[model samples]
Target chain A: MILEQTPDKSRKISWSYILLGISIVTIILFTLAPILWQVLTSVKTNEDISAIPNVYLPHKITLQHYLELFERRPFWLYIFNSALVSIVSTILCLLLGSPAAYALARMKLRGETIILVLIAVVTLFPYALLFLGVLEIIKNLGLGNNYLALIIPYTAINMPLTILVMRSFFRQLPQDLEDAAKIDGYKTISMLTAIILPMTLPALVTTGILTFIFAWNEYIFALTFITEETMKTVPVATAQLGGASLFDIPYGAIAAATILGTIPLVILVLIFQRRIVQGLTAGAVKG
Target chain B: MNNQRTGWILLFPALLLLFLIFLYPITRAFGLSLFTENLGTQLQPVFSGLANYQRMLGDGRFWQSMSNTAIFTIVSVALELVLGLSIALVLNQSFFGRGIVRTIAIIPWALPTSIMGLAWAWIFNDRFGVANDILQRLGLIETGINWLGEPGLAMVAIIIADVWKTTPFISIILLAGLQSISRDLYEAHKIDGAKPWQSFSQITLPLLMPQIMISLLFRFAQAFGIFDLVQVMTGGGPAGSTETVSIYIYSTVMRYLDFGYGAALVVATFMILITTVALVAWLFNRTKWA
Candidate 1:
């Protein structure tokens, strides 16, 4: 009777495991199906793409759509523009944000709470709400169509998260390390570069990745600020692909563009998934 | 004294930029809203105190977009919270390849919204969209549906896309919250002969409240100002049914070149956001006590 009962219980546990497996598969499919569809669509010929009843699988895979994207539009230019803006803005955000975060975390400064609260509020302000004013500033500064137009705003927008994340990391560091560096006659700048920064390298990388992803994916400002086709970022350029022609929709080329644009981000997510999750949770939960 | 000075010096640059980008714009928007500046005025500022505000009172488009925004935020956020919490709970349990699953889960959140919006638009395309194909295969519909061409359907499509992209973010935050929870509580509850559901309710929900509230508020502000998705998907669409406040404001200032009214709209939207956030925060606080 005992042996029979144990086998029955083990079978029940296996059944539950099966249920869990099924659920996991469903979640993965739901998360990936759209992206996978795009991948399939990207390689399909234009005829196959517009086929009646829809072509679930292409008869012949072709690179024609990708070639067409480059031929018909400044696709390479868009990639270059996006990369330049994202990298520069990310670096700027880190440079400016790290020091601020350090000061707030380490130094016993007056009005620290007020500054933090201000940052928290600013973090909540949608960039859409600030566009009109920012546009005005860009125009006044003659920064339109220039990379500065994108870089400056991206850095500023990402600053709040950068500071908040880095500040939390800084707070977690041992105070004795800083005190020891001070005793060794290290100045603030020297201590930061020599001791403090190296200790928070992981934090910097996490914040940098978050900032880079935001700068890369940003749309509204990219659309409004950079009207020059050569200067248009990936998101804006890819969006404009639809309306580039009146008659033909270029769905195949658009698919190719979408895949190309998302490849870098997908790679980032795959490689630094842990750090990205950490940065996001740290910024939101801790802040 | 020296340390305080160093702190101020270090903090000043970031604070200055934040002020210039955030605070100044908000204040300037308020001032600009009180003036009439548009093509009708040759893009020149004419003092028109409260005129834009008055116009907003009778503006049907503004109200429609506002209502649409409300629907999008409330519906998408509610769906995300439910879906996100479920995903978090599933992830919290020990499973094989959990790390890879979590990584794959967040890819949607990491991709550019505009790019994904375009992908979603194509997915819902009238002629060759996979959405129609899948639904037909499942025998859910007899014929092709023009998902983005119809008003109500367009909103549904946009909401679906938004939820897909953002649910992962909420899940990740909740997963962190779940990880921080001590396992001893669950074990003790189980020893008491408590059902799994009961333990989850008693041990998980209350502890995870803060993360839930944070994601809710964050997603609220984001969905309220949603621009990229709607703009790319339907361009506010078949009859402006999917036009969010951000899209409306963009077209107002950028397309119509109506800076004054645009600024007014900005200020009004900001107030609504602030009030709702405060109300939600207060409600959450009350619940915590209760």
Candidate 2:
């Protein structure tokens, strides 16, 4: 009976192992196929792109689509605008959010739970819903077509996530460290910059990357606020890539533009996968 | 008292910005909804109490968009939860090159939704699309399906794009929950002669409930307000069939220049979202108690 059971168990284990292997492959293919197809389409010539039988792979890869994309539109301007807005907003969000998070996490503040709950709710708000009012504000303040138009809102929009994630990280730290700093005659600002901030650098970087991504990818505000071609961000520019008529849709150039727009984010995700996951889950799970 | 002062000082800047951006807009939307300001009214602000809301009561387009938003949210969130859980389960296991697989899995979520939506549009194109080509090769269908041209299929296409893009987010959250569960529970369950399915149902599901609820609520809210994907892919087209509430409001405000009616739509959508979130939270808490 033992011998029979041993074989049966081994067979079952191998069967499940095989199943797991298949599932992993399927998951990878499902996630990566559309992206890989876009890459292929970008490199393919117009002839191959619109071929009757469909060209799975390019016959001869060409840089013409990429060239055409740059020549036809101000693609470089979009990239520059995206990077500037994302970086500035991320820096601003961190500057404002860190102290608030520290206060909520470490300081004996009144109504801390209410404040935190408010932050969480705000974090879940769909920003598109705020576009009409935000646009009005932008127009009235004459911030339209200016970098601050995107920067200010992006900074404010990202603050909740930044504060929530940082607060969670701060809560996990030992109270002894802050007490030690206090005994050393440190003020609140100095104590934060000198000790707590240095220790929670990873959390800062996590929140910073997440903020940068959000700012870079935001669409409605970018579209409504920046009408100038030179001020458009990657998402808005990419969405507006095709021709006026359906028949003249620039598939190849659009594909190239999509690839160009996504490369920066892809690199960021690959490098900071662990931190990104940590930041995203830190708020939701802990709360 | 000094420490409390310092704490409030530190908190003041962020709180002020949050209030200005979030609470102010919502309140202003409600205020703006009670006026008549659009192209037809010569873009001049006029006081008209409850007129826009009354119009919404008789508006078929608004109702259709609401139902569409509901379908998109329900179907996409449900799909993401199932797919995400499966991926999380697989990722939770130790395997060779697990890190690479995990990174690859989340690439979709990391990319901009608008750009990916465009890619999906091409993929679902009638003539040169990879989707049709593959189906034809596999003998699944003889003719190319006009994915974005048909009303029902347009919704399906957008949902597919949305599911692909967001499943990674849900999976990552679930994977975190899976990691927090103790291995001892599974081992103890096995010792009690529990099957793999039994252990998973009894141990994994119950333990992962909080994360599940959080992801569901987050995904539901995001999916309901979906704009970029639908805007880029179909532009809520093939005859307004795929238009979400966000898309409807966007057109009302931007295209039609109807600020008053748009504000009304915004306020109504916000109320619906808040109520649903509260209801879901209450239901989850009840389940937890039971």
Candidate 3:
């Protein structure tokens, strides 16, 4: 060692412990407050929500807003449209992405880094860039306010990252398994199904979850493509909560819808926290 | 031979889809930028050879949007980086309930931005909003402040909402960076008479630079084109103060039916982003951080 004098190392450790405790409390409270406020707002009566000096808690927790959300707007359609588009896009992304990824992984394509960078760059584009051309195509095809309008673009927008994530996973798999499967008389397609598919469950789940969340929360395309009241996705519908008629901006109902719209994602994040955490850090998915 | 064929076959469908949806549209937008047709006068396209871009250089709204985009990007991403690194460092310590803490952190990032923007809008709402209420109660102000009804405050509100929504993402990325740095380095540094702060600056910072740069790039791009938050929270607002380039272009094309000009704006924004990314990448490579 070069030297030994460091100021009060033991005391520093104790001080660090104190700092850690304070940080934990602060982080928890800071992260939880806005959400908790919204949740409280969800349960509050409308009058309580709008009350001067703001109601900190629900005077009476009610499901009326939840029910009224469905009654007053086409909230159910939003959920259905969101689910259908996200699920289909995620599946399509996987099916189309995985095979290409497998090829990149196994065949060891030239310009692999270039391809990955290109994909990354694609994902980085202003999502609004996809709006105009896609909108024109949708209108030209007369897919007016239709699910296909959202699906085509969502699937396309999500594909690059999906491929990158899947490619990384596929590349990490051992090659001897594929060799063994080939020796056992399995063709490339069969080997992919029988050997590779089962091995990539974690990657598939992460990609699917991330992709679904992206599509599910996608706002711009949904807002632009689907203008009809009946065709709105969850985000569009949620934004339109107060826009139904200018006179009727239901605060509690908006909160209830937000909470409702967010529940599935919250649950997904809880279940797949580890995979999501890993995928995010690897730069495999878009921010 | 068979394997190569299979590989190409597998890639064909995805490449075709990408060509149709992503690449093709971008090319169309680029080509559309050189036109003279006002979408309001006629839907027909006429090639005018860079006229739209020429006009963009002189447009005040274009400059406003460019700066607005820059301010939003610089301020929000800078805050996210600092806050993210702090939280990441905190989380890196072995602590009680770390898993729960991490999950709690992910919740905001996981939720939809527009919905959360709505919540924030309510929070900042002047009449019955929590922000004014809390400020009044604490004697921070004597009267209600119209948080989003003013230009500067509106931008600040957007930035605040953006930082709250996105800091977790940067924190998570940097956390992964912090975790990957070997504990043994710090241990060795301790023996060498290096204080904790010294070890952090000399070791953790340089080592974390790659992740930090990458995360910054990602956050920069995202914030540069932010639409949902501003659209929902302030809608480019109190007097076009928060009008990001994305918001501006969205209205120019969608609301005002200026497709040619809008296309020019998109292409211009793309060039700016590309140049910024290139410069950053060059810097990183020069510094060997990439």
Candidate 4:
């Protein structure tokens, strides 16, 4: 609206609209297709799934796969385990990461940069070897197949980014509130609890969701540590899904399970996408 | 000085956990890599220095996995970069339904990779899979191709799956970069009679280099250590052809229970990744934009 409608500007027929249309179509097809296909398959009968000519649409929709999924397998347990582990570990990550982040943000020290780099580098550490080491130590500590097995490592591994995001979030807060609280003889912890935390609810939620998603999605540790069937998380249990022989692909249950497993995260993403983006970019851009 | 002391005290818990969970385990892995310890036997102190390393060097499967890792990382990251940049460019535009589109874009990224890998495996299934059905519908192929059956096609399938899941991550990072660019530069370029492509190349790419490199480094390290997708889709099969270093090391440690050799493999993998990251970081630092 601000632009002067020069002859050239008026002559240009806004090809960007056309481009936008094409991009939207391509994005829908590429990005949404697989997920949509999974959803469709989730509702299809097994016969419909492997029909001679791919049954683009299900003739008869059924909740049988969903029923069978829960009946045949303890997927409820997997969901419960995933929820408990992710929730606890995400909390633990925030508790540990917040203090360090606050310290780094507030303190001006010679080795501050070095410490930040150290934290950042840990996130870059390859997990294959790291998981092997962690598993050994867990076994040595007599913690194999225990919930602590996954929780401790998940909390530890997610620390770097959590700290970085929290640090960036903390740095932006006004010093006046803390100074005012100090004048009233409010201690640091109480001040943080009453004022800073209550004020930074968005940041806390952002950090919490980011860590929650990471812990939920983690596979290798959960797979390796919890050899017991019931202890597996959704991701691992879904991967090693029973009833799918090499010959007969359990497309029905697999589809149902995939949809069921992913729907919660997708809902969270739909809600808090902006916050997640902030957390993701905060570390990369600042570093 | 007072603040520093207080800060350190505040930071103590995180530091302690890092030492316990991350640093200590890393150092212990390195130490364990030095000795030959078979997991079947008792925990004995028979130190066989460099033996595990020697075995790793001679192992064909190790080299195969190393190469497989290199191929997967390089190819997948390359495809993701191109697609991601395009997506970011489009998403950056002001248009109708952009909010919905942006949310849709992040969904693939939010979905767990391992589960998505499973989804992809099913989608690319030999007889009744959608990939084959779609291709055949388009007249691209005469018959259903067993996408995960052959080695090369399996690699392609996995890479495609990886790209689908991860491109959004690259796009989001680059979109953040794209949004931060000044409008004045584009307007100036427009006044100068520069083409859109010219503006993109001259104005945008240069400014977006830092984000580009960071995403590259981040994704490179991630793709290098890819496990779940490879594990789920192929199980590194059609004869261990798609097996990555992570899968190899994982199988050695978990399935084979070869602690010593797996440790050596771990150390080797660590060295490669660390060196590559350092090199990329050095390149990043050398670049004027960085």
lDDT of 2: 0.93
Each model: TM-score of chain B? 0.98, 0.98, 0.97, 0.96
| TM-score against native, each model | 0.98, 0.98, 0.95, 0.95
- For model 2, the stretches where C-alpha displacement exceeds 4 angstroms are none
Q: Return the candidate ranking by lDDT, descending.
A: 1, 2, 4, 3
Tens-place lDDT per residue, model 1, B33-144, is: 9999999999999999999999999999999999999999999999999999998888877899998998999999999999999999989998789999989999999899
Q: How would you class the docking of model 4?
A: medium
DockQ of 4: 0.71
Clashing pairs in 1: none
Please say which candidate is ahead in lDDT: 1 or 4. 1
If both were scored by lDDT, which would come out higher, candidate 2 or candidate 3? 2
Query: For residues A1-287, could you state the per-residue lDDT of candidate 2 as single tens digits?
Result: 99899999999999989999999999999999999999999999989999988988789999998998788788898999999999999999999999999999888798998998888887667877898888888888989899998998999999988998998899999999989999999999999999887898888999999999989889888888899989999999999986879798999889999999999999999999999999999867775
Give residue A160's error in model 3 in angstroms.
1.8
With candidate 4 superimposed using the best TM-score fit, by how many Å does residue A134's alpha carbon deviate from the native? Answer: 0.6
Candidate 4 scores a C-alpha RMSD against the true structure in Å of 2.7
lDDT of each: 0.93, 0.93, 0.85, 0.87
Clashing pairs in 2: none
**Model 1 lDDT on a 0 to 1 scale:** 0.93
Model 4: how many Å of interface RMSD? 1.3
